[model samples]
Target: MISADTTPPLTAVDKGRVTLLYHFVRLQMPAVKVSEPTFLTHLDRTFRIFIPKAPGPVSWAAYLEGLYAVDWLVCVGCLTGQNGAWEVLFNARTGRSDCLLVDALRARAVRLYPRDEERQDTAVTEFWGNLIAPDSAGTLPVLARYDGQRPLAPWLIRVFQNWHLSKLRQSGGTTALPDDEIALPMDTPRADGADRWHETFIAAAREWLGSLTDDERLLLGLRWRYRLSQREAAKLFDLNEGTLTRRTDKLRDRALEHIGGKLVAEGWAGDDLEGFVLTELGSLLTDDPRLSADHLGRLLAARGKSLPAG
Candidate 1:
């Protein structure tokens, strides 16, 4: 359950909020022709499809809204761009202090272009053969021509590092995605700006749902909440797809039993726990609005605290 003091939900992609994105992209990717509608679509797809599904109807709109409210919109833009190279560099800096960027670049370059002497590393093998082969659009050979011992240009890599670090220092926390995951299509068109705003809240809900202990809740988060492919979810949880299927089925049954038992214990014979959970999350956001944003930050921060060190 969330505390009562949280602020109302507001999103960056809300009706009039995307003028900033339009202005920013107008300057950064001048050749790419990013518009309000197109940026909104990208933001929506990112919020709706990018997060785990346990939290019900989580929305990035609120999170992004706060980000923009605090003038962290530039970091958000960097993450959502066509190539989030600087974003990836920013994320890599969190755990490292001394020479983090340089070390990460060296590690990334080594993994990207391994020597014949170090062929045993799987990350290296996969980087060239699997990762680049597909995303290159047949221009990988051209890229490799200049990348012998060094895959990326030294100066370009430095620029990416500098840009990412500057944003991190300015914002105080991270908001970017990795570089490899950004795959904006060349000819994407205009979208309804509202779509992005709606999805942000939904993503936040999914994040909350992921925190629950019930496997049914987890399954619900995975299938309907997060909209993740079962295979993808299985990989994330370190289980096989078949195992996930079985576990989810069992979870559904057990959840019903547990809910029914609790309802009976509470003097309500037929009350539904699943429905209660769903309705509670939905109503919490819709009724209060402010809870959506405040709860989301608390939920995310709490989860971050519980994660173990690698």
Candidate 2:
């Protein structure tokens, strides 16, 4: 079960920071056209939604309050015909605004140019598709960091431009590998009995992969296929790295448990089940294709399974 933080609720210092932010916004946004009550309502809503959910180490409530202040400043600038003023305020308030801006832009591009659904190599496409979609909770953190610096839409476009450049660098002028070339290794059994076992294992693995939701598959692909470090993967997905790591570990554990149950149902049991699954099934079930058939056969042989005649 997930453990909840036992930290106390927002403190006096937090409230003080928020109060200061409230006053700052009220002072700076005098011409924003929003009534004080309406402005306060929006600020309260922002705090309610983001305070508990903010990424931490620092005071998330205070950070959000500051963002609230900046957002109002930007709104006032936009409202008063002060072009580009929002960007200046946002950049000045948050030094890391460029990074968030880049992420937002890439997210938008993914939505604008969705790939063909029938394509086999759609992992990268799916990654971005999920990132920018409306249902993605990952976007909340990004939104909380938005200080109204520049219009949101233009900032997102700039992010897309950066993403496009990065993608070009990653491609390195090479075409993608064919599907068959990237197929998972299959064990060719020397005996009919071994062939049956091999087929059974493959079927189980495919079924397990199929059982995962699109988001789960995307996470796995990012970590395994793209070989991204947890930090890089988390940033791309708009998650805290620690949260991403924990979720990835949980997914792996769940997959292993399910696979173990399948093996037990097939009359395999004992401590060796986990070792076999991790060593044999684990290698075969990866997104990487470099694990040779010969290597796979050796692994199966170690498990006391002889191959069937082709």
Candidate 3:
């Protein structure tokens, strides 16, 4: 449900944050850098994640592949290193107080104060005491707020960045994330990159899937809705495993082509559309309720199996 509202356009503060993040990552390595215009384009996609219906609680998607559509991937990577931080954030067997995510964030804090050991230690101390501390009810509010609608690693990275951003600002510092030589850039973001595009990605998905044939729809339903394996699904349709594989692959491509074309008609350019399909398309289709997988069971009465409860 990609709901719409009269929510005002991106504010100066939003642009400022994006500009800062864009410069933050580009300053690192060239190989990991995304162009400023491309970053701004994806920024719009990121803001849509928070469907802020006025005064109502923001409805967000489950966090299977959040970073899939997000910009500032390299910057995010810089904050959360590849240490299976995703698992540590919500692993049933792991503890939250001193997890891999915390360590990665601690490393980010270290980057903020590379030459100053005392400040680094103090920053890490404050982070643990404030964010990781359990409340009187014996629950960590920061970790508890995670609803699995977005990746915990990036969510925690934003939380960590905001913490430091506020701290530095409150301490009378002018920089967003202060370093000995680096600071977040201050510049306006270009909001017109994707002309006339107003988050119809989900709507397009619903229409595309709705147009599929019964058999075609059920093929997707078996995998996404019923959570059936390829062998099981193939057996259901009485097709060989190899033939089932090719058909599913074609369906995946067709979805991309259809969605990509819709966006292009809405003023998305070649590279911009490609950027989304390659990087962010996974987020929407991964666990979407309307478009891809969530409710297909209700539509599959022909299967004769008891439909799953809502």
Superior by lDDT: candidate 2 or candidate 3: 3
lDDT of 1 by residue, 1-310 (tens): 2222222344544545556545754665343444567565545443433233213444445434323221122223433353453344334332123344344444543433346335324433433242223434655321222211111233224333343345445878332332431111011232565344234434444454344564344345445423567786676556899999887777555544554444445454334545644443432233222322223333434444221122
**CA lDDT for candidate 3:** 0.52
lDDT (CA) per prediction: 0.40, 0.48, 0.52
Predicted model with the maximum lDDT: 3
> On residues 1-310, what C-alpha lDDT tens digit does candidate 3 reach at each position?
3354322354576556556656654654344445577665544444443444223433222222222222234323223332333233333121123345555565567665667788877876775555435535765445433333344454565566666766766888543333322121122232774324435666677667667886787787677645678898887777899999999998888887998888877766556565566444444444443433323443554665434343
In terms of lDDT, the poorest run of 10 residues in model 3 is 180-189
Which 10 consecutive residues of model 1 have the lowest summed lDDT? 142-151
Each model's total of backbone clashes = 27, 11, 5
Backbone clashes counted, model 2: 11
What digit string (tens of lDDT, one per residue) describes model 2 on residues 172-289? 6222221111122122224545555555566677678768764566567656544668997677667899999998998888877887777778876346666666665654544222
- Residue 153 in candidate 3, Cα distance off native in Å: 5.5
Off by over 4 Å in 2: 1-194, 282-310
